[model samples]
Target: MTADERMAAARASGPPAPGERPSIAPAGRLGSLLVSSGQTAVGADGRLIAEGRVGAEIDLAEARRCAWQCTLNVLDAVRADVGGLERIASTVRLTVYVAGVPEFTDQHLVADAATECLLRVLGPEVGRHARAAIGVAALPTGSPVEVEAVFELA
Candidate 1:
């Protein structure tokens, strides 16, 4: 799906639960770059889509889905910040955080879900970017995953 299509779908799905603010500035402009705050796997219902640590209460598959949800939240924030996704030139950086138990080393794989969603909605050239996947002891709101990004404005 294109970014517009993805945005339309998210709108049709409905806004997040009322009164729940984004964890940080959805997106902010610093010169030509748009820096996005970290987003968790919050659903439209205003609930964490997946909770607990990977390799523990949350499995890889579910964590991957949560990663995708976080990506959508990021996109929503980007749209609100830039006028439209068309104004985005290309992704500059992506950072994925996975709450995981000790010895859980597949953090990069979990992060791929967010990258895949970006590519699917924004196209390959624009979505491709440098990335880092981190494993952490815990995450905010108990979410299994969180995603943050930076993009260049066209």
Candidate 2:
């Protein structure tokens, strides 16, 4: 969606409850996160950018399916929050966190599921940023995967 449309849509969705915040705070110093955890809108240089989450206990699946669902939902939430797909400036970065068992060291391979999903949704622009796939004991909503993005506004 265009930045304006996305912003407007984001304003409409309001924000998720504070308790619903995803544990997306990657270890980095990005000048204080623009939005807090679980927040659908984030501010960067005063610009309000929006993101969304999708998943509940009912959405969980095996690793591969979970990964695909996560990426799709991330884009779905983005589109819903932002509006249409014609206004995106760039995808700055994406971080995917998966809840897996101790033997799930294959986290990177599973992460590919998310990247592929983004490629289909965002096209070549998906190649513009760095990414990471991490394994954890649990996700905010017990989801198998939770994806988040950093976007550049037009």
Candidate 3:
């Protein structure tokens, strides 16, 4: 599918699911760079697509889905704040935080979904980035994963 189609499919359109949603502010620009706030897998109804620790409460596939959803949120937030996706010159960095049990060690695998989604949407020229995938004890609202991004403006 085309990038726009992919984006539309990810969004699935309409309002968020009815659940707890963080108060998110738009990404801010510092010089020619745009830095985004944290985004989770919260669906259109404002509820996390899946809640709990990754290794204990959810499987790898489910955690991957959450990471993908978080990526979409980051892209949308950047698009919203910068007027258009084309305004993005390049993806400078992506930081993925995965909440999981103490024994979990597949945080990088979970982050791969976000990386793939970003490449699909923005293409490699603009999407390739420096990244970190960190496993954490807990995350706000019990989300499985959260993502933040830094982008260079055109």
Model 1, span 46-112: residue lDDT tens: 9998789999999989999999999999999999988899988999999999999998999999999
The Cα RMSD of model 2 versus the native structure comes to 12.7
Clashing residue pairs in candidate 3 (N, C-alpha, C atoms within 3 angstroms): 15-44, 16-44, 16-45, 16-46, 17-44, 17-45, 17-46
Off by over 4 Å in 2: 1-61
lDDT ranking, best first: 3, 1, 2
TM-score of each: 0.84, 0.58, 0.84
1-154 per-residue lDDT for model 3 (tens digits): 9999978987886565789475768687899999999998999889889999988889999999999999999999998898899999999999999999999999999999999999999999999999999999999889999999999999
Off by over 4 Å in 1: 1-23
Tens digit of per-residue lDDT, candidate 2, span 1-154 = 8999999998999988876865554222234222112221223333222221223222223555666665555555555545654445666777777666665566676677667766777787643556888777776434566667675544
Clashes of 3: 7
Q: Give the TM-score of candidate 1.
A: 0.84
Q: Each candidate: how many clashes?
A: 0, 6, 7
